[model samples]
Target: MEIRQHEWLSASPHEGFEQMRLKSRPKEPSPSLTRVGANFYSSVKQQDYSASVWLRRKDKLEHSQQKCIVIFALVCCFAILVALIFSAVDIMGEDEDGLSEKNCQNKCRIALVENIPEGLNYSENAPFHLSLFQGWMNLLNMAKKSVDIVSSHWDLNHSHPSACQMKELGVIFYNCSCLVLDLQRIFALYSSLKFKNRVPLTWSKRLYGVYDNEKKLQLQLNETKSQAFVSNSPKLFCPKNRSFDIDAIY
Candidate 1:
């Protein structure tokens, strides 16, 4: 009798199939889940997110503390490097000012090895630039013992010029003036001046009479008369060495 009652209690397929199927199907979701924040939600909420989460923020300038610490570390390293450099310089010389004093008191390397570039900008502040041939000649003349060449390239003869092939460069005047004027501009008379004078100091004027072009260095005391006898000084471009002098004249 008990076994028959247990079989009826259990929903055996033969006993009550339709009634058991209806019980298994859900009528609706639980009220606690569908009500919203208690358990389940269809979409995310702003309040549910943590403060640490972020989107774009790639520039990172907002983190002032990290940037300040990095900058402070760099400044400390630079200060340390500067200190080491000064210490090394101090070790090189016995006294603090010894290195600087030696540099000021001496003139080294009378010989020159020049490397002037081709197609150089004409409107430079330089007095003038020599052609490649003139610079080579000058180097030969100045260097008796040894020549020290400092050059980015060795194509002086091929690239820029040998003797300034371009007539418009005014480079011939630049070279020839230096050669001739260095001779004409120098004299023993200038040695007695209280302030020492150097080469490229003065421009000279030569005057000759029309008696078959007789050559002489004549002295005329009158300033007014002297002006008429001498040719008007050549264009300032030919002789101007100092930028301030060129600027003032122009």
Candidate 2:
């Protein structure tokens, strides 16, 4: 009898469980579970794929642009470095041509003038002429000072009386009637004076002449004059190989 009772109790529980399962089957899945499944399916299909691709492309473009910018900056820096080096070399060469403190004595160039104007001829003159002359003078004077001497012969009657002071200041004049005179005669007078003073004189043949081999020689001669003056005149602090002479008043 006890065995039958145990079997009936187990059977009753099995039947009740079957009935509960049948009732639960008609209910739909939980709302939360259904939403989770839908989200997973949408992610797999990539419904917002267009927006995602756009964002990805934008990011890639930004990175590439940053790299290009870095490269351009490097190139600019390199160009600047090269330019600085070239400029330094040019400056060194120019400075080398100049006389040092040790050689600043006993060297000078001299210019002899014939019919110089009354006042100092320091004006550069018309535009272009003045610019070139002034530039050359600046280069020369930086190396030395005090031109040797300017001399000419003037017959006071024909000469501009204003030029008289020039003669007094070592600018000797012999046969000049007035400052208004021939250019060649003036140069000749200057050359003659240089010869007499025992001072080496150089000419800038192209003061207003053709720019050919002759012009280059004149410029070279000008440099030579500077050198001679520096070497010879020890009283002044100038190099032995720097002297310049100018026929122009400036």
The model with the greatest TM-score is 2
Candidate 1, which ten residues in sequence have the lowest lDDT sum?
206-215
Residue-level lDDT of model 2, residues 112-231, one tens digit each, is 333344564655762222232343355456545433332335465654354444432222222221211222323433455445645333322211111112122121222353111101
Distance from true location, Cα of 97 in model 2, Å: 12
* Model 2 lDDT-worst window of ten: 226-235
Local distance difference test scores for all models: 0.38, 0.41
> After aligning candidate 1 to the native by TM-score, how far in Å is the CA of 32 from where it should be?
7.1
Question: Could you tell me the lDDT of residue 170 within candidate 1?
Answer: 23
In angstroms, the error of model 1 at 52 is: 4.1
lDDT of 1 by residue, 1-250 (tens): 9999788777576556777778887898878767866434433544344332443243365676689999999999999988666633434432222323223212122222234455556666755544446656765786556544322356656545553444433221112211222222222123223244443343322111111112211222222112111111223312322122233344
Task: Give the distance in Å from residue 94's predicted Cα in candidate 2 to where it truly belongs.
Answer: 8.1
Global fold similarity of model 1 (TM-score): 0.22
